[model samples]
Target: MDEYRAVALGTSFMMLSTTSFIGMGDIVTKKSLDWVLSNPKIGNSLSILGRLMDDMKSHKFKQKRGHIASAVECYMKEYSATEEETIIELRKQVNKAWKDINEEWINLTTIPMPLRLRTESCTYQ
Candidate 1:
């Protein structure tokens, strides 16, 4: 897979997961949904973290089963990087994503603490 496609898949996955969690928490009103939609950085950050972590852990297994390229593979191919180098760079990105998540969470004063917790809790697991 290419860079764009890998990123888009991750973003879509994150949005779907985040939205479902919020909906389950009964916080899916128009205003709340709008806020979630408008402020996507946190979700995107979470997506990047989740995608890279999963790919890093499962890439070998997936490859053994003939799965398509993951973000790790895409990065390696695009940059002509070794696995170790790719992993190191991806780890840096994951750390940045965590930082972004914390920053966004701190700035989210409009949402109730409980609702905010509900949205972020899923990402922890």
Candidate 2:
């Protein structure tokens, strides 16, 4: 979305959301929107981390053609680091993203629960 420039995770997440509105409609439609709008950090971090990972995996193929600038490229440019160092930093970023995801998900429990709770809601016979 940022056109080969450094992009925030929220923008990546927005693009991801566009791909499969069908699936996301059911999953991230309502409650998720509240949190996403209220505190975009969670979703942004997820998408940013995911984008870095995706770019890492596909950088070789993407580099040859009309691919957008990935996190790797952005980081290398920003930090003036070698490819190896950029990847190491990106992986560290992914780990950090997971930690952020865990924290947000746990905190978001205060919102409307997922439908999965219906199953567990049943009493033991």
lDDT of candidates 1 onward, in order? 0.73, 0.59
- Lowest lDDT sum, 10 consecutive residues, model 1, at 5-14
**Winning candidate number (lDDT):** 1
What is the Cα-based TM-score of model 2? 0.66
lDDT of 2 at 25: 43
lDDT of 1: 0.73
- Residues 1-125, candidate 2: write the lDDT tens digits: 25443443445454343332335346655654544345355556666566677889988788888677777777788789999998898899789987886776566564446422321122111
Error of 2 at 51 (Å): 0.7
Model 2 backbone overlap count: 1
Q: Which residue pairs show collisions in model 1? A: none
* All candidates: TM-score: 0.81, 0.66
